[model samples]
Target: MQTLVLVAHPHLADSTTQQFFKASLPSTGVTYRALTAQETYDAAREQAALRQADRIIFQFPLYWYAAPASLAQWEAAVLTRTFVYGDHRYPLADKELGVVVTTGMPAQAFRRGGTENVTIDALMAPLAALAHRAHMTWLPTLAVHQFNYLDEAQKLQLVVDYQRYLTQPAPDTLANRQAWFADRLPAMVAQLAPADRATGELIVTTMTQQQDDLEALMATLAMIKEQDDD
Candidate 1:
């Protein structure tokens, strides 16, 4: 699946959070662009890119409960009525819309009694509404809270999590997670050094066994349930 990440930060060169995220992006099946890097946008061109993507992501830092001015500006110039819905083509329909927002505050702060006192979802209602208007599927937002506070392990985990968010199929389940890893394990093992390759191959073998065992157990349960229903 093709995924487009539109970054809306005014100073993309200086944001470590964004830089890290960019570094974590998979080499294939993903395209990224900084929306604010250019002075103006070509409405037709932007719409065409959006149409090509299976998943569209808006990545930015929140500014006063909304995306920065650049995002709004891009929306005004590119998201023309005729392109989105006026013609009734609904070009974005069946596509996925998602958000990746980085924040200075903690996750707990985005609650009724917390410091910000407003949930991230509430702040992002407009974008979700846009997805609804265009018949797009709105994905659950990926919120990064206080990036500077994360430790080494958390950062390592985020790499996998972010990659999955971009490429993994919807309704994230254990089976799907296994499938995603299994698909990449061969290439991943090939990239490792000779000394570490054995361990990588072992992990792949073990995971395959686990997957087969899990499937067998699930099929057994299904048969028992079917018999009970009879």
Candidate 2:
């Protein structure tokens, strides 16, 4: 998938969480744009990037219950009516729009009677509305709450989770997960150091067996369903 990550952070250089995410990005099939780093807005270029991306991610730290001002400005400048819907082209139709928002507080803080007194989803209503209007698929927001407090294991797990979020297909089913890893297994194994290459190959073989077993079970289930229908 062609993923576009638009980052809006006023002090990106100082943000450890943001830096970590940047380092964790997949090496291919993704484009990164820092909104604040740009000298000026280019509506046509921005729109072109959006059109080319199969999945677009708006990455930013929450500010006053919303994204940073640059994101809002970028939205205003690029999401013109003629481009989105005025001419009824719907260039973004069926594409996915996701958010990767980092919050200072814990997940629980963004709930009724909690510290923030509002859900993350509630704060992101405007962006969701935009996706709806454009007929694009609205992905569930990926919120990183209190990144500084996460343990090393959690951070390591986030690397894989975040990568999958960008490239893995929607519905997040087991079969899809298997297929995704399966597709990448060869390249992943090839990149392993010689000492570890054997282990990587073994993992690929094991996963392949598991996938075949899962497919066989699914086929049996489908046959049972058909029999019941008859």
Top TM-score prediction, candidate number: 1
The TM-score values for the models, in the order shown, are 0.91, 0.90
> Residue-wise lDDT of candidate 1 within 127-208, one digit each (tens)?
9999999999999999999998999999999999899989988767778889998999999999999999999999999999
lDDT per model, in order? 0.93, 0.92
Span of ten consecutive residues with least summed lDDT in model 1: 33-42
Q: Per-residue error at 180 for model 2, in Å? A: 2.1
Per lDDT, the best of the predicted structures is: 1
RMSD values, in order shown: 3.3, 3.5
Cα-based lDDT at residue 92, candidate 2: 93
